[model samples]
Target chain A: GAGVSQSPSNKVTEKGKDVELRCDPISGHTALYWYRQSLGQGLEFLIYFQGNSAPDKSGLPSDRFSAERTGGSVSTLTIQRTQQEDSAVYLCASRAIQGASKAKNIQYFGAGTRLSVL
Target chain B: EDKVVQSPLSLVVHEGDTVTLNCSYEVTNFRSLLWYKQEKKAPTFLFMLTSSGIEKKSGRLSSILDKKELSSILNITATQTGDSAIYLCSQIQGAQKLVFGQGTRLTINP
Candidate 1:
């Protein structure tokens, strides 16, 4: 509604089980980003979508990580055959680029989904 | 590759102590540098700096960006326990992506 929102605040899944996390960005905001933070580590950029197209997926750690955005609003990040090392907090952020304001690039972040692969 | 570097990855200080966090970017065509304070899971935005040498201040927190050095600094005066959190520095890179540093973890003891 007023800010970026994410789903499945906490998820505990067995190894090899696929998990899907969702993100709903601020309304009418065009740019969306997904990042992963391992324990005691900085955020690692996973992928970003600019109007349903991901121009840079270079940060995806491996083939097991995939993401997609539909309708340029809601985005989904999926992990295939998850492993223990895949456990981390997945954060989603959104920013508005429709205006010429200097703050247009400021990203509003979600509470994030904490995934634990057991 | 565009990346941000932060110094003093971890710091512990008593209340009322002043501290300065550093951030440097290695991004080409850098648009802006932003500072965020992350508490728990969500990170709250603090400041966005585009022009050099202009300091943005909010209460006990202040930040300055230097375009010539490709660096920025976040200064906190009269720190309190509530100010303890992960301070993140991000650079606006190509395609509107935010290139973030490893983050500086500051802990303030009461």
Candidate 2:
């Protein structure tokens, strides 16, 4: 793949409705990241995956927010009982990592999914 | 080493104006720096500067890094309305992830 791909470019859900966002990383990309951006705000890190393993999950905003990556390729971010505050753009990015220092390598981003909870 | 700051949180200018965006990092061990332009949802890559005093350019967009001052600046010449976007800067913190700064919102009026 030439770049990262995200599904459901725009989603509008009722408050308390469950929402699932998907991300498909570039071929052979070992590192994947998820971020959230509210209106007029900077990107906030949510969670990241390294070969299907998330070393840190503290970035998750709350218990309702959870993410999983299977087969180290596609990832899904699930928001349960979504609130109005969850209405924001969810961005996904991926980077090809080989050696140790490559973990901070350049990341290719996908056209983010705008999640709107009303 | 997660501190990254960008100046001029927001700026508005007419077309053909030249603008400079600044970014400073306090990372003890700096490896690489990156600049990105966010138009809509996706942020397109602009430049990556690792060496001090060396300028990286693409079209009318150029950027330079200063290690001693722990800062970097992005210069866009003859800005167009299409150049209206949020410019982001990030520092590579080891091999874990990127430490990004609060982006500078640039708006170019036609």
Candidate 3:
């Protein structure tokens, strides 16, 4: 695709249900990020993936939140045991992974998936 | 701990008015400061300021970074209704780390 793409622009699930959100980054991008934004709040970084190395999961809120990047192109964010508080727009962004370069860090974002947990 | 703070949690202004938004941060090994405008969904990048005293401009929006003060300001002139949105500021600490501020909600009435 010409730009970053995300699936299921909107999702609704009940508590205790597990949900998966997919992201297809721009071609050749090596860095992918997952962020969550609640109502009237800033983005909460969930995880970061660079190539096939271990993802930086420091920002994930809990164990229920997990993500994986496959083949260095597509990624998926999974949320288990959904709660009402989990309702928010999950955004995905991708950027080139060049070390110490200013242009490398510019992230292009997707439209995001609006997840509603009942 | 790293933190980003934005002032004027919310503001109301009329069209044609000019406004300035503030963002302050405390982060170690600060790589750069980023500005984004968020509306209904994902946020769109606005500016990335890496050096102090250098101003970045895009249309009516301009931003300047102050490395010494650990702050940045976004200025908009002759605002329009379309300019209404949540303006967010984030501090890039290191590889794959961006700490975001709570954001400033700007409402420009037509």
Candidate-wise lDDT, in order = 0.91, 0.87, 0.88
Specify the poorest-scoring 10-residue window by lDDT in model 2 chain A: A96-105
Candidate 2 lDDT over A1-115, as tens digits, reads: 8889998999999999999999999999988999888887777778879989997665689999999999989999999999999999999999877755434467888999999
RMSD of 2: 2.3
| Candidate with more favorable, higher TM-score: 2 or 3 | 3
Give candidate 3's total backbone clashes: 0
Q: What TM value does model 2 have?
A: 0.91
i-RMS of candidate 3:
1.3
Candidate 1 docking: what grade? medium
State the lDDT of candidate 2 residue by residue for B1-110, as single tens digits. Answer: 47889989999999999999999999777778888889988988888777643579889999988888989999999999999999999887644566788899999999
Fraction of true contacts retained by every candidate, in order, equals 0.64, 0.26, 0.57
Local accuracy of candidate 3 as per-residue lDDT tens digits, B13-94: 9999999999998966777889999876768889998864358999999999888898999999999999999999998865
Flag regions of model 3 displaced more than 4 Å: none
Q: Write the per-residue lDDT of candidate 1 for residues B10-46, one digit (tens) a residue.
A: 9999999999999988866767888999989988999
lDDT of 3 at B72: 94
Q: If both were scored by DockQ, which would come out higher, candidate 2 or candidate 3?
A: 3
